[model samples]
Target: MTTAFITHHDCGLHNMGPEHPESPIRLLAIQKVLQKTGLIEQLKQMESVHVTPEQIQLAHANLHQKRLEMKQPDEGVVYADEDTALCPDSLHAASLAAGSSILATNQVLSDKVDNAFCAVRPPGHHAEHNAAMGFCFYNNVAIGAMHALQQPNVNRVAVVDFDVHHCNGTVDIFKDKPEVLVCSTFQHPYYPERYCDIQRDNIVNCPIEAHTRASVFREQLEKYWLPAIQNHKPDIIFISAGFDAHHEDPMADLNLTEEDYRWATQLLMDAARTTCGGRIVSVLEGGYNPVSLAFSVQAHLEVMAGY
Candidate 1:
C-alpha cells in the first residue's frame, strides 16, 4: 500500500498572527510543494478527525485540557504564553492536528499503509504534560505514541525528534516511562531550555551548538540515536520531524539542507523497517521559512513514500 498523507483544512485556520513564525502558510507551502513535486498524488490522502478530549487526556493531564478549553477565544487571539496563542478556531484546528497523528498511527499499525505523515499542526512537541508553551498546545506525537501503545502487540514505541529545538515537552511527558524511548536532537542554550540535562536512559537528547552543519548532525545521529533505537527495537517509530534547522531557514543557525531531511527520513525508515514492519508515523513540528520548509517537507515525504 501507499503511504498515508493525513491532514485537515482546520490546521490552516489556526493562525497565530500575521507576523508569527508558525503561520498557516506553513501548511500551504508544504501542500504546494508536494503538488509541485508530484508527491501529493502518489500517497493515500485522508482528512483528519477531530481529536476527542479523551484521546488528548491519554498524554496530558485533565487540567491541561480544561485550561486549553477555557483559554479559547471567540473572536480574537488569546495568548497561552508569549509565544503560544488561541484564536476562535485554534482549538478545533489543534484537535484536528492531534487527531491527524492518531489516525495516521491507526493506518500504519493496521497495515492499511506502508507508513504515514501528519501534515497538520500547532506543532506539539513543546507542550508539557500540564502546560502549553513554545507555540504548541497539545503534544500530538506524544498523544499518538500513547494511542499506538493501546494496540495489541505494541508494547514499546520510539519517538525520534529532529526539530532544531529540543522537544522539552516530549521528554517531560515520557521521561518516567521506560516503554517510550525519546531520541531528540536540538540546539543547546536555545528556546525552552529545560529537561536537556535530565539523566534518563530512555530519553536521549543531542544538543548541538549554533552553526552546526549536516556533517555534525549525521555524526551525532549515528553516535546517539542509532544505538538507542537499535537497542529499543520499538514496536513502532514516531518522528517529530522539524525542518527549522535548514540552512535557509530563518529560525535557527544549524545549517541543514533538503538532502539532510531525506537522509534522516531514510535513516529512521531503515530503523523502522528492521524493528517494526516499517511502521512509521511522522508529525510536523517546526519549519518557518515557507520556501525552504516546502522543499524540506517534500524531501522528507519523498523518502517516507519510498523515493
Candidate 2:
C-alpha cells in the first residue's frame, strides 16, 4: 500500500519566464495542494535520482544530449525555443526532472514502493528524440520507460500519455518497436504536432480537438487506451501524467476536468492491477494554470494511491 512521490528542489529553478505557461510554478501548485489537502501523509516523498548521460541516451540521441549540454547558459537566459529557455540552473533542473522518473521507475521495480509519481517540472512530453521544444529538454518519462524496458528480464512495457500536447518525443523514440506500446491522446493542431504520419501498430495516437470534453475522453479511454494496454499486457506501465488538458488550462483547448484525470488514472490503475501487480510509474509532464493543475494532480494521485 506504499506509494512514492519523487521530486527535487532544483526542478523549481528552471523558469521559462514570468509569462510563459510552463513556468516553474507548475511544481509549486502541486506541492502546495498535496500539503493543504493532507495528502502528504498518505504518500512518501523521495528525492529524485539524478540520471546519467547514458541513462538519458536510452531515449534521446547522443547528439541531442551534446547540444543541450553545450547550450547551457553560463548566466542569463538562452533559448531552446521561443517558449523554452535555459537559465544558469536550467540544466540541473532538467536533470532532476529526468532523474525523478528514473527514481520513480527504480522505486516501483525494486519494491521499495508500490507506485510512484514525479512532481518535478520542465514538462517533457513535447521534446522529440533530437529536438527539444515545447518547454522540454529531455523526454523524462521516455527515459524512464526505456530504463524499465531495457531491464534484462523485462519483456513488455506500455506507456500511456494523456497530455494536452502529444508526446512527439516519446512516440518518435518508441515507434516501430514491438517491445513497447505507446498510447497517447491529446489536443491536435497544437504545439510540436502529432507523429501520426509515422504509422506504427505499437503507437495509438488519438488526437482530439480542442475543448473535447470528459465523456469523449472516457469513451476513448474505454475504446482505445485501456484495450491496447490489456492486449499488450505490459510487464510494466509508464504514464506521462500531464494535466494541461484540464478545462482550466489555457495552454490548450481541451475541456477535461479533474474528474477526467480521476477516471483515466483509475482505468490505468485497474489495468496495472490485472497485468503487472499494480506496477505503474507515473511522471509529471504538463500542467499549467496552477489551480487546475493542483486539482487534477490531486485527483490523479488519489487513484494511483488507491485513495
Candidate 3:
C-alpha cells in the first residue's frame, strides 16, 4: 500500500506576513527539504483540489463560510483578527488545503492508499465552526474527520492533535459529536486557554506545561491517548500533526524534538493498525522555525511511509 503526499502551490500563496511564524515559506522549506533528502521518492505525490463551500460548512457554519467569502480581499491582505489573515489567494490555498485531506481520507478509506500526509498550512486546528483564529481560516482536520465519518460508512473516527498550543477549535467542534473522538496534547495555560476543564467524555485533553520534554509527551501518549483509543476503537484515524513543540521552535516552550514526532507517529500507526483498519490521514497544523519544521515533518512522513 502506497502512502500519498498531498499538497499544492496554492498553499504557499496564503502568506500571513514576513514576520509571522506561519509564513508561506514554511511549506516551501518542507518541500525543498523533502526533495533534497530524496524522501519524495518514497511516497506518491498528488495534486490537491479546492474544497467546496458545502464541505467547509460541514465542519463550520454557514455564516462563517459566508463571512469568509464576503471578506476575501482582492489586494494585499485582509486581517481577520490579530493572528489570522487573508491574502487575495488565501481562500484558494485554504480551500485546497482542506480538500487535500478529504481526498487523502477517501484514498485511505477506499484502500487505494495506506496512509497520507498533507503538507499544506495556515494551520487549521484553531478554526472552529463559527470563527477563525490562530492563523487558521477553516478547520482542516475537523473537515477531514467529518469526511471520514460521512463518507464510506465509517461509524467511528478519531482525531489526535499534538500542537504546542491547544486545539481548542477541534475540541469545541467535535465535543458534542458522539461518533468522533478527539485527543489533544497542548501546553497548559498557553495560547487559547479555554480547555482547562473538558466537558465531554470523548474529548481527551492532555495539557502539559512549559519546557516539557519528550519523556512526558510519550508518557501521556501511553497513559491517556492509547487508553482512550483502545476503548473507542475508531474505524479511521486522523491526525492534526503539529511540529511546533520541537525544541528548536521559538513559538512555544515545549522541548520535544523530531525524534519525538517519529516515535509518536509509530505509536499512532500501531494503534491504527490494531483497530482502525490501518487507515490514517494527517494534516499539517503548526510548526514554525523553517529548519526544525522541515526536519520534523520529514521524520513524521518517513514513519508514515513505513521507514
Question: TM-score of each candidate?
Answer: 0.99, 0.97, 0.98
lDDT of 2 by residue, 1-307 (tens): 7889888888989876687787878888888999999997899988886779999899888888789878888888899888789888887888889998888888888888889999987878778888888889989988988889877667899999998888888898888678899998888777776585568889988888876666888888899988898999898899999898888888888889898899899999999999888999998888888999998999998988879
Query: In candidate 1, how many Å is residue 15 off?
Result: 1.2
Supply candidate 1's per-residue lDDT for 71: 89
Q: List runs of model 3 lying over 4 Å from the truth.
A: none
In terms of lDDT, the poorest run of 10 residues in model 2 is 189-198
Which rank order by lDDT, best down to worst? 1, 3, 2
Q: Which RMSD does model 2 reach against the true structure?
A: 1.2
lDDT of 3 by residue, 1-307 (tens): 5899999987888877798788888888999999999999889999888888888988998889779868888887888998888888888889999999889988898889899999987789999889998899999999988877787668999999998888989988888998899999988888988665787889998988898777999999999999899899999999998999999998899989899999999999999999987899999999889999999999999999987
Residue 135 CA error for candidate 3 (Å)?
A: 0.3
Angstrom error at residue 198, model 1: 0.7
lDDT, each prediction: 0.92, 0.86, 0.89
TM-score between model 1 and native: 0.99
- Could you tell me how far off, in angstroms, the CA of residue 294 lies in candidate 1 after the best superposition? 0.7
Number of the top-ranking candidate, with lDDT as the measure: 1
> Where in model 1 is the C-alpha error above 4 Å?
none
How far in Å is the alpha carbon of 187 misplaced in model 2? 0.9
Cα lDDT of candidate 2 equals 0.86
